[model samples]
Target: MRFERVWWGALSLLAASPAWAADGYSVLGDWPVKATSESGIEAGLKGNLSYDVARFGGADGGAFADDDAWRRQELSAFVRKPGMFELALGYDFRNEVWLDNFVRISGAAGDLRIGQFKTPVGYEESAVSTTATTFMERALPVTAFYAGRRLGADWTYEKIPNWYLNAAVQAGGDLLGDNRGRTLGARAVFNPVKDENQVLHLGLSASNEKRDDDSLRLQVRPEAFLAARRLVDTGALNRVEGIARYGVEAIWQRGPLLLQSEYLRIGVDRDGVADYSADGYYLAASWVLTGEKRGYKSAAFGNLKPRRDWGAVELAARYSHIDLDDAGVALGGRQRDWTFGANWYLGQHFRLQFNYVWAEARRRGTGLDPQIAQLRAQIYF
Candidate 1:
């Protein structure tokens, strides 16, 4: 009933919006809003809901039973001004929700962001969650060693008209379960040319974390609280892990051919004496069969698209790899994926996506290679 009410309210709002006019219904302002004009604080909401279907098979196409299907939902609200700041709030289906990338005020060319947000160390790492690569999963190395997201402050500079730069520092966790714990990290990006038709971007980032003993106590379920305490008392818990990440991506679009590539490296600080490092990258090209815009972000280019349009369509593919063992704890693994995807635009306030991934993972231990395939669909505004 609660969900129905929300839906009904949204429908009514859309019906009465200026977007509806007197003709009929339009996709614009269907539910949430988008940043259209840069007047007073421009505010809007966005959402993502995707269905993930996975199938696990061995190299020979035999099935594995551990695979299952799941659904994911995310909602976010953002407010941005042309001047000094932006605020965002988001909720993910994983029982986790917080201020997405709340940034503080900074000087002329630099701004600071704080809170739980994706790391700035990698190029794609900063892509809006809903507008990322594949839905069911990210790239291989991005999954294996990428630290996902952490609480931190980010700084960015765009003093030069056609050039931009960014840096960040983050805290990893709460002191224990109470939110006093933290992690430390930083990242920087340099863009030499920034234009609608051409651009060039390059970046580097890294971070380290020290876990809190108290926060460690709360990671377990209530049922295992006693066990957690026991492990802590015996010092059997692996308490420390630090992560370092670096990546660069370049994207270019000329006439109708769109090309992009990302190179990344990750190092992990684990317990005991076992350490690990891995590197992976992808080079992809796409053709806008219909002369549509293929907006992409990279070391060479960032978001590129013109306003006013019914919509646009793009088809793309990518290849990726990762190897996670240097000191031999045996976490070593690699994967390759052949992906086909499409993007649809419903004015500035809506986007729809579809992707199919044919992937295979190779593991070091059993000399077994597992093949997996998945499909994902998402809507964002």
Candidate 2:
């Protein structure tokens, strides 16, 4: 009922709003009002909304037969000045209402940012924005191991050509409260080849976290957009003291073809119990049928652009696997997923995506295979 209301409300708002301009944003709709003082202070408003729907089948039971939801991914405003110092505040209307705020300072050497932002851990998790992902949802491995938004301070150094470094220290909970834990993470990326026609990126990332009184749980869905039930869940492990995660990623692009892969390992330490570890990896490839190559910046892939009046079309496929059973725990099940996706870029701010997923999982001597199909309509300003 509430989800339906929000979904319809977002649709109504989008329909009532003015159309977007060629540059992909309307001065009146996107940057409705912007002002610059003589001292170089500037301010503006920004927001985006996304809606997702899904149908599930082939499961032992009707786990996720049908589901849908609308999310106000980002509704925020920002203020900035000449020295590249800025402040931003927003709310994320996902499953829960939460505040998203941050500050940034830039100088000759590097940039320092403090805010509630996504942690830098995996290539795909850090690179692709939610509004512009190739698939309806991220891979299962990424969802299981990667840390989402956290209140933290991060530093980035990219003054050296073709080299980038990022480091951060963050609280594991949201601004409203904190009960999860604290984390420290770092990443380094080097681009040996960068050009208009080709790009190659190699990166490594690691994180260390101190758990808060055995409250950590690891789980993931079957790469479905609207399904809420996780096929694999480690239900709250006991006496968890700490966790460490490591990842390696690579991306290669030539012309309109792109290939990417990443591997992640997470180790958990417990009190009076044998330590255990879990790992996962994924491989994906995409091709732009409209001859518009995906853009690469700051070690991540940006959104696709339409090259013709008909718009841009992209086809993508992925294979992902995650194994959570280790020396002491067997509850977290193991899963393998194969997904095929298509994306259509009507313009810079409007996109439609479709995905079909086949997932297989084994737990406690039982096996289940599920199939899911999902669609998404996204609009942003």
Candidate 3:
């Protein structure tokens, strides 16, 4: 409680800063701590803190402990010369993992980056920022079946108009030294109708990974972080040596309205056993109530900028489903969820989000359905 009190005090001061009212206040360009040198190098320090103020009913009945909404607390430091080169380091106080400590070099050949970065898959799973997602938590599908961050080398090319390509090779493990696997991944995107007010985009991604130990466990909450137990779970499946994942994504944005969808399928290859498969998908839509459009940059979606200094408001809905039962492997079972969300952006550095999830999961002839409500307070820079 004392730590939370101190954090809240700090947030109050940031909320009163005059800098957040500037027209240049941007999710990527503006920082709470920024400076520039005569040599034309820029440096910045940024961070975010998000937590659930309260949770009610639903899956979080204090059944499994940890019924708090302490989502994330992260800080990042970066130095760059315009866009030609940049170095960044990020750390998560809550998860105890290195986020994006990487070096990036840009040229006519596109961009090359090496370090701990995202693996270039799953759109909603990789929202530009933790605080920028349309909902307080990511959809169930993305959470259940995606390789999040990894230590790796990646290359990207966007010289061709309306086209983007990314290739990456990952080894070692995540910054936490878990899931030590060798993975090769690639993604391609085509944005045909790109303009100020209208856009259409399609993307495909695939990855193949081999682990030192052939085992995997898949589980996820019911679209609520404060939920005590994961509704669907595959305790542990061993014998598999490799995994292959394929995904397809699409997005259409028109003014203040945006529609997006994604599908992910995975194949688990086991030793002396039949391969098993799993799949999941989600559909999401959002409408900005204050005439602001969601930001899009570098093949990713970002937060919306308010046309007025008063800030922006958005309404969103998502339907997500995941099926982990394949062949005789029915450990995780199937889950379907419907989530309705509302977000209020209070200037550049703060926002408030609320979500209600209706979820149902069936496993081993047993079914669980819960209606949950949660609210989150966020501060980021």
Candidate 4:
């Protein structure tokens, strides 16, 4: 019911608005709501909302076990001055928590970022935004191994030609006061071939995390939005001391086609038991049917832009795999997912996405295969 209301509301908004091409890269343009002063201070509203619906078949138990919901993804506002600094504070409706509340200062050398933000990890985990991803959700390996937002400070240096480097130290937890531990992470990317019509990007990342106690769990959904259940979960392994994670990423883009792949490995150190390890990887490809080339910036791919009045069309496919069973632990399970997606970019602020997913999970010598179909309506300003 909630999903239906939000879905309708988004459609209504799209229908009521005039079909005007967005100005440059700003979706809202210079609206009356924004203010700019002589001192270079600028303030405006920023928010993104998405409603997702999904149907699942051949699943034993999970949120996607024939269920759907409307999710309030992100809501935020920001204040900034060009080339000086910016501050943004927002909330994530999906997790019902605070979003990226951070301040960044830029200079010739690099940028200094502070407050609660995402850790420098994998390409999909930290480099890309939810609104710009090619798929409805990120790959399972990224979600399982990469650290999300945390209270921390990060430094980014992109002065090197065709290269980007970032490092950060963060507190492991959300803003709601659930302090988990601490983490240190970094990422480096180099674009060997950067051109107007083609790009080849290679990147690597690593992170070390120390947990407060033995309780640590890693899990992920089967690449389906609104799937409340994680098909693979490494339920709270006790006496865990620390964790180390590593990742490698590569992306190649030519004309309207884009290819991306990443691999992640994690090692958990237990107090008295032998260290356990898990790994996952994914490969994805996307193409713009309307011939609009996908944008790339800061070692990540941006959103698609429509050239014609009818808007832009994109088709994407991805395959991901994760293994959580190791040594004496066989409870988390191993899973593989294949997803196909189609997207319609109705201007810059609105989009319609559809995805079909096939997932197979094996645990304790038993296997379960589930198929899911999902649709999403997204709006941002």
What candidate 2 gets wrong by more than 4 Å, as runs, is 1-42, 59-61, 81-83, 97-100
For model 2 the TM-score comes to 0.88
Q: What does candidate 4's lDDT look like per residue over 241-280, in tens digits?
A: 8889999999999999999999999988888877789999
In terms of lDDT, model 3 sits at 0.81
Clashing pairs in 2: none
> lDDT score, residue 219, model 1?
12
Q: Per-residue alpha-carbon lDDT of model 1 for 1-381, expressed as tens digits?
A: 322443354445445545564566555534536655745677788776654434445563353432323244678888777565677877776435442656556567577767766656555555534444423345555444455566767666666554445555666542122333455555555556555664455555565545554212111100110111110011122433654567776666665566767777765566665555567776777665556454443232322232434445557666665554444444444556656665544444444444454555444444334344443334555
Better of 1 and 2 by lDDT: 2
Clashes of 2: 0
Clash pairs, model 3 backbone: none
lDDT: the better of candidates 2 and 3: 3
In candidate 4 the C-alpha lDDT for residue 303 amounts to: 82
Going through the candidates in the order shown, the clash numbers are 13, 0, 0, 0
What is the lDDT, from 0 to 100, of the residue 200 in candidate 4? 99
**CA shift of 119, model 3, Å:** 1.3
**Higher-ranked by TM-score: 1 or 4:** 4
Model 3 TM-score on a 0 to 1 scale:
0.90
Question: Cα deviation of 335 in candidate 3 (Å)?
Answer: 0.5
Please identify model 4 stretches exceeding 4 Å from their true place: 1-34, 58-64
Alpha carbon deviation, residue 292, candidate 4 (Å) = 1.0
